[model samples]
Target: MERTGTMKTSKKMMHCFLWVLALSLIPSAFNGCGGGGGGGTSDAPKQSNNSEITVSSNQINFGSLVANQTADNSFTIQNTGTRNLVIGQISTSGAPFEIVAGSDHCSNRTLLPNQSGTIIVRFTPTANAVYTGSFVIPSNDPDESSLTVNLSGVGQGLNVTINRVDSSVPGNIRMIVSVTDANGDAVANLPNTAFTVFEEGEHKPTIVVSNADVHPVSAVLALDNSGSFWASRLEVQNSAKTFLDQLRNSDEVAVIKFAQVIQLAADFTQLTSAAEINNLKAAIDAPYTDSINATLLFDAVYNSVDRLILRNPNNRLAIIVVTDGQDYDASTLLPGSTHTLDEVIAHAQQAGVFIFTIGLGADMHTAVARRMANETGGEYLYPPTPAGLNAIYTKISQILINQYEITFNTTKLVGTLNNLHVIVDDGTMQGDDAISVTY
Candidate 1:
């Protein structure tokens, strides 16, 4: 009985030893087969190193812009990882917002580790309203493959002004119109079918001439450099240069600065090159005396038209005058004052010149300016502040560049003071003008 019990105890001890050995080998088996327990083994799972994309901004606000004006902004994309970032696709939402071509650095390109790229965005609103859109970019970023940039803008209203109407030939009348939306913003692409005409207080079938058919413009800039305008002299000169910059290569411009007497700064010259425009700017920047502190408004107007009428007789002629005060010389205060208001008007009529007048301050003689513009079939403007000078000049330049010539048979109304009226219908908007035509 004792020998059998001893044999059973031996057998149980052997079984316990085998179980302990198997438990000890389990950790070694797991470590040899690429498990988490291994720290310095070649078969361990590798850590991931992925490329990431980060943007400079996610939103862009364009503030406020005039209709048809263009504005731009830029954003940056950085690759913040250990691998190269591949850009796949780039696109915009729709109109008024676009990715400017040649300005994107990430299109179908690879950005190495820690490298950055740029994307330029442009906004051009066609009408008055608030607009919203987005720009999308797809890349090989591990976390974020698709990115978006939000865009917003506001467009303001546009104001149109008819400056003048004149007839060089017997049966045709030329109308000068100015269109602007905001400071330094001019409206464009106005169609020809937007005009109508009435002759002798009767509706006349009018023919509209496209801007391409009109001849090049001949314009004279009449500036008032009196003591009252001293505060805005530099700005005035700069604004006049802006006006010259807006003219076409085929257009001719002359400069006339007046205080008590009219001084010709530049003769009629084509603005074909930068040198010519700079020469005119330099002439405008020349020195002048304030000793004769009188406003020779009428004399200046008459002389400016006289200078333009002879140069481009067949081309469209115009005189733009800027003044801060009334015609002090109209009272005959200065010695040897040559021209009167009536004589100036008659000369303008005979030469078929349109006159545009701009009044600066409350002391401006609005009545006289209005009379001159009205009698010559031109328009008068009174800007609220000096900062608005550039915009007004830009509008005038656009007007000269985009005028319509309307023709009607006036042979039956010869020697008669006929009333002329015009209407311009542009889809949702309409404009009208009336004047007296004497043959």
Candidate 2:
């Protein structure tokens, strides 16, 4: 009986060993047949069922950009996956670099398998410097959940401003041109011959002189302290003060405040001393106790031009009008009205007085201001906000100081109203501005 039992136990052991060997071989068989062997390993890489993201470029170079100017570029994003790919938030890291609006196709969007889209980026440099930033893109990519595109650019410093100055000489037209670097500093090294002037009928300048040699200026500040500007009175005062501070000591300024009536706050006075400038600021900041019933816009401008023409006909004459409303006094029902638009424009042209108008708010008549400026060879500026007034005033002051006075004897030119065109070229840069003269 003991021998029989030992033989049976040995047979049982052999059966157990065979069963274990068979289980191992079964997995190998399934793997070789490409079956679903959950516990088996393969030498080949496993294919993922999730989405994958790819980009056309990893970096963007904008090269060089001018301060306050904008440049743009674009890139493509693709989905190489069997399943749908979803893109999430997209953002830029720097102040100047920005993702252009309506240009990002992947933001909060879904892309089907093998689909692609484009994204546009823009750069606007406010100052001169090397700018660096990145665009961060988040997506449901298995390998890369987030992607970054490096951005780089350099800002250049160069800007040119031109303004016309009134001249009493028959056929003589003057221009105040300034070249500023990125830092807003004047560049004085440019030669006088760099300027090329053109008349309406002719292609060349009669005569051009770079006023790099300083000259005196006669300017008038025609301010509207009317009801419309009451709320922004402080801003107007500050802007006027800032304008005065920027003028040269040799420049003469006059102040005219117009509301229901025009008041000569300060007569034509030379801003040669700090006390004179302070007195002018005080006059500007003075209370507007007068009634704000009407705005004597055209009349005020006419009177200011008359004041400038009477005081200094030989120097560069300019009238800067700051107003927030149109000429309501022209209705004939109002009092203290003296001149019409046509009269003002005629007087300005005859006297060679340039009119620079600054319309403060949307309520101001842009067309009238633009006409006045265009007729007298001046500029019209409408600042979007009160904060921009100071900058505009500073720019005008710079133009006044760094002007190019062009004088040519027009004995042959015969006309009461002559068309004048001026061109300045420094080989690389050029500027063209026009004016009308009554000789």
Q: Residues 1-439, candidate 1: write the lDDT tens digits.
A: 9999999999999999999999888878878776455545655665458888888888999865556667778888888878999988788998999888889888788999989999888898877678999988799987788888889987655434444555546666555555444443444576656566677667666566455325788889898887677788788888888998998989888988988777889888898999999999988898675444777777888888778778756677788888863667434665334677778877887777878788786577666777787577565666788888888887777667756555555554446676766665456644355566566
Q: Spell out the clash pairs found in candidate 2.
A: 176-403
**How does model 2 fare in lDDT?**
0.75
Judge candidate 2 at residue 215 and give its lDDT.
65
What is the alpha-carbon lDDT for the whole of candidate 1? Answer: 0.74
TM-score, per-candidate, Cα-based: 0.57, 0.57
C-alpha lDDT of residue 217 in model 2:
81
**For all the candidates, what are their Cα RMSDs to the real structure?**
22.5, 19.9
Model 2 TM-score (2 dp): 0.57
Error at 63, model 1, angstroms: 38
Instruction: Name the lDDT value of residue 367 in candidate 2.
Output: 68
Q: What's model 1's TM-score?
A: 0.57
Task: List pairs with backbone clashes in candidate 1.
Answer: 163-379, 194-424
